[model samples]
Target: MDKAPDEAKEVYSHHGVIVKKLEKYNERESACSSSTFISFVSSGTLSVLEHNNDRWLLWVPEERNLSVESDPTEWEVVNTEKPKPPSINDEKLESRKIWINVKDLKSLQLRRNTNKMFFDLKDGTTFDVVFQHGDAQQFISSFRSFVILERSRRSRQKFYVKGCVNRELSKSFAELDLFGEQGNLVARFMKDLHDRPFETTLTAFSKLTGVVASGLSNTLRPDDEMVSQPSLQGDEYEVIPSTLDHPAMSLPPRPTIKRGDPLSVEEWMRHVQEDGSVIKVDTLLMTIFRGGIDPVLRYDVWKYLLNYIPYNCSQTEAAELRKKKIQEYQTLCQQWRSITPEQEDRFSLFKDRKSLISKDVNRTDRTIDYFAGDDNPNLESLNNILMSYMMYNFDLGYVQGMSDLLSPILMLMDNEHDAFWCFVGFMEKVMGNFMLEQTSMKEQLLQLACLLQILDPVLANYLNSHESGNLFFCFRWLLVLFKREFTNDDIMVIWEVLWTDLPCRNFHLLLCIAILETEREEIMANENGLSDILAHVNSLSMNIDREAILSKAEAMYMQLLSNAEQLPIMACVTLGLPVPPDPETGDHEEHLKLSNMTPSDDDEDAFEKAMSHTFL
Candidate 1:
C-alpha cells in the first residue's frame, strides 16, 4: 500500500527516541530558525541505515509502519522506507523524518541527566533528542562503530569525529606555504632526510614520533588507566626547577612568597575616606595585587579598579556620576531597542549581530545558578548590555568570547548600569584581542615567546623546534583572560588582580610563564609536539592552582628585576621596563612598549620590525 518501502541494510535501530527540540538552518536566509520544542507525544525510531555506500542516522515517527517489539532490541519492519531528501515546501514530511549523514556530524554533546543528546552538524543545524525509554549510551556506542569518535579533552561530554578533525588539520597544513614556492618544508625535509640528517630535522622527527606514540598509547590505554590520577593539593605546590641547570644562566633561586588574605572590609574602609575618596591608592592597589579583594568588597572595589568611579570622586560626586552614567547607558540601550521590524529588514548587519548576541547570551553561563533556568531575567540583562554596547562601539561589534568576559561582571555587579559600565572598562583594556586582524594578539604571543626564551631557553627551544614558537596554545587564555581555565570563584579573584595592573604591565604573560614552568617537566619528558602541547595545555583547564601560579609569577617578576641589566633588551621592552645602555657601545636604545601597540596605529609596523630584528 505504501509503494513497498525501499529495502536498505539496517545497521542499528533504537526505538522510543523523541525529538525534544529542532533547530534548522535556512540556507536561503543564511540564519538558523528559532529552536522549537516538540510537545506532542510523538515517539520515534532512530536507526543507522546503510544505503548507496553511505551511512545515515534516520529518525522517523513511530506512527509510520515500523515498530519495535517489547524486547526493544527486535524491530518489525512493515513499511520502512528511506527518507526522501528534505524539501522547503513539505513542512509535514520535514518534521516527520530527520536524517543526518554520519559524515556531516561536527560534534555530539551528551546530557546524562536528561538522557538528551545534542547533534551539531557542519551545516549549522542542530537537534536535541531525548531518549524516552533508555539512555543514549547504546546509540552512541552504535554510532561510534562507524566513525572514530574521540572524547574532547576540554569537555567531557563532547566527542569529535577523528576523521573530520584530521581532514581539517590536513587542509590547514596544505594551505601553509612554509618554504615558499620552492616546496613544502615538511615534504622537502622528509625527502632529504637521509641526505641532510640535520640536528633540527632529527629533533623534529623525534618529536613527531613521540607525538604519534603518545597518541596511540592514549587511544589504546585500558579503562583503568584512563581514570584520572590524584593531583597534588592542600599546601603542596609544584617545585620550580633550578635556574643553574641550564648553562650560562645565573639568576636568584625562586622566592617563596605566601599569598596574603583577601583585602578585608575593615582594611578596605580604612583606604576609603569619609568623603568617599580612596586614599593611598598605590597601597590599595598593592593590597589587591598581593591578595584579591574580598567578594563582599568587589562591588565597591571593582568600581574603582575598573575606573567606573574616579579615585578622587567624593561621595556626592560619585552619586552624580552614577546618575549621569545611568542616563548615558539608557540612551545607548534605547538606540538598539527602538529599532523596528521594518528597519531590521534593511539592516542585515544589525540583524546578524542581534541574532549572534541572542544565541551566545542564551548559552553564556547557564550552568551557574545566577543565570540558570529557562526564561531567566538575568539572561535578558546580558543581551541588553551587549546590544547597547554594539551601539556604543558599533565598529568593534560582537565577538564570540566577549560573552565569556561579560558573564562574571554581570554576576558580580548584578545591576544593568553598573555591570554595563564595568564591562565597558574591561573591554577597553582587552579590546585589542578582538580586533579584526588580531595583530595585538599576535604581538602578545610573540612577546610571550621572547620572554620564554629569556626565562627558560630550553623550553623555548623545544617549542620553537617543534613548530609551536607562535605560542598559539595560550590564545584562549589571553583572549578571555583565563575565564575558561579557572572556576567562576577563582576567576573573580584572578580578574580583579589582573585589573590592578600592579607588579608590571602584561603580567598575564608572566602567569603563562608560571604555568609553563610548572608543566615543563611533563612537557619535556614526553617530547610533546605542537598538537600534543595544545592538548596538554587545554587539559589544564579548571585544575590550575590560583595562589600558587600568582605567587610564582610574582616571584618570577622579582627574579627578572634582580637580573634586569643582564636580560635582553627585548625582554626589558616586553615587561615595560626602561632599557639599559648597550653593554658594548654604551649607548641607549629607544624602548618600545609592546603592550601599547595596536594594529590601527602606525606603531604596529615598528612593533613588527622590532620583533623581527630581536628574533634575528
Candidate 2:
C-alpha cells in the first residue's frame, strides 16, 4: 500500500488563524479594553507566491480550499499603496485585508509560550497571528530564516571595502586573497536562499551566516601573512561547496574606449557619396559610430540622420522638400493658434495641454544662451514650436521631457519651421516613450531588464532581490535619450549618430548597457541599493564621456552578436535583429526590422583614422 501523506507537513494546509481588532465599541469591554477583537480568520491558510519579477506575496485566503499559489488573476490583490498609519491600539478601523506584502515586513517575532507571531511592518503597524503550538513553531522557524536572509541582502549595500580590505571579511580574507571568491560565494548563497523558502534555504542560510559572521569577526594587521593564521574555535568558517561555483556571480570585464578617439569632419567627408548624397546607410553609420559629427557639419548631417532629407535626396530635392515642410509646419501651427478660447473651452484637454506646454516652455533649457535672457525670441520660438506640436499630435499631448528632446534640435536648425519639423521627425523615434499609460516605457524597461539579466545576472539578481527589477532608474535616460546627461553640443553629436540607426536597432538601449558596464565594478563593489544606484546614474549627467559611451556600446553590440545563440528572444526583438537558429532544426526565424536595417562597417581602420587625426 502507498504511504499516506504526512498530515503534519505544511502543503498549502487546510487553514490558519489570525486575530483582527473590532471597530464596534463595547461598554464593559471597552472601559478597560486596550484592544478589541474584530474577527478571527480561522478559515484561511497562508502561502507565499511570487508576485512581480522583483517581489513575493504572503497571501491569506478568505475561504477554505482557496489555492493562493495558483494564478494571480484568482488571487485577491491590493493597490500597492503605502500601508495605513498604525493605530494607537489594534482596532479594526478598516476592513480586513487578505494579504500583506513581504516587502513591507520590517521584522517578525514569535512568542513560543503563547504560540503567537507578531509582524512588525515598515509602516510601523503590528499584526498578531496565532497558530496551534506545533504549527506556530514551524511557521516561526521558517519565517525567521526568511527575515534574516532579507536583512542580510539589504545590509550588503552599506558595507564597502576600505584600502583593499573586504568589509565583510575584514583583513583575514584580504591576507589570504580570498575576498573576491568568498564574497561572490556569499552573494550567490544569499540569492539562492531568497529565491525560495524551503528547508534547504534555511539550512543554507544558517551555514552562510556562520561563515559570514566568522569572516566579520577577524582582525588582522596589514603585515600579517597567509602563514600566520588565527582560528575561531567551533566557528564554521569554511565555504559551502555548492555556492562557490555559481556562474552568475562572476563579473564581466568592464568596457573601455582608448583616449583621443573622436570622429572628425574630414573622415565624415570620406563616406559621402560622389553625388553629394549620403553614402549607403551602413557607411554613414560607421562614420558617425564614434567621435560624432564636427560642430560645423552637424546642421547638414543632422538632416540626413533625422531623415528630414532622405539618404539619396540631392541638394536641390532637399531644398524643395524643405520649403514644403516649412509650409506644412506653419499650417499646423496656424491651426492651433487660430483656436479661439470659445473652441478651447469645448475641448478641455486642449486647454490643459496648452497650459502645461506654457509651463514647460518657460523652463526648458532656460540656462542655455540660445534660450536665456529676458523675453528671448528663441524662448518664444521654442514655445511656438511646442504649441504647434500639440496641434500636430493632439493625442500624445505633452510630457515633461519632450522639451529636453526638442531643445537641441531647435538649437541646430535655423528657423522655427525647420526646428518644428525636425522635432516632429525626432519624436517618431522616441514618442512612444511618452505615450499614454506608459506602455512604451514599461516595454523598454522590461527589455532593458532582460538585457541586464543576460549580461550580468549577479547585478540583475541583486536588483530583483531588492525589489528594483523594474529598472525605473533608467527612466530619464530613456525618456530623453540622455539629453540631461550631456551638454548641448554633445547632445547634437549623439542625436545625429542615434538617428543613423546602424549596427543594431534601438542602439540607445545598447548605450544604456554601455554606461552600466563602465560602472558595474563600482556598483558591485559598493553593493548599492536602488536609491544609491538611481542617484549615481542621475549624478552622471553632464560628466559622461560621450565617445567612451559610444565605444563601449559598440563593443557590447559585438559581444551580443558573438553570443547570439545564447541571447534571449526579447533582446533580439528589442535590438531589431534576427533571432538565432533553433538548435533542433538549425533553422533561423526572421524578424521584421523596426528601425533602419542598413548594416554598418565594424572595421578598426575608421577607429584608427579617427585617433590619428588632430583637430586644428
**RMSD versus native structure for model 2:** 18.8
Q: Please, what are the lDDT tens digits per residue for candidate 2 over residues 283-400?
A: 5566676556678877777777776888787667778899999898889888988999999998666776687677778778878888888888888888889888878887666655
Which lDDT value does model 1 have at 375?
A: 89
True lDDT of residue 11, candidate 2: 25
Per-residue C-alpha lDDT of model 1 across residues 1-616, encoded as one tens digit per residue? 0111266577788887765334554431124343433213346788876643345678776553332232221112222353433333456755568777765677788865546677877667677666767777666666654444555544657765422112222222334322122244333222212211121221222222222212212322122122222212222533221221234346777678788889999999998888999999999999999999889899988999998999999999999999999999999998999999899998866787798789778878788999999989999999999999989998878866788899999999999999999999999999987764455665576567656766787887687666565565676688789888889999999999999997988999999999999999877766777667766776788899999999999888888888876664556666877776544555564222212322243453333222221110
Candidate 1 ranges with C-alpha deviation above 4 Å: 1-248, 583-616
Single out the weakest 10-residue window by summed lDDT for candidate 1: 192-201
Highest lDDT: which candidate? 1
Off by over 4 Å in 2: 1-246, 249-276, 525-527, 585-616
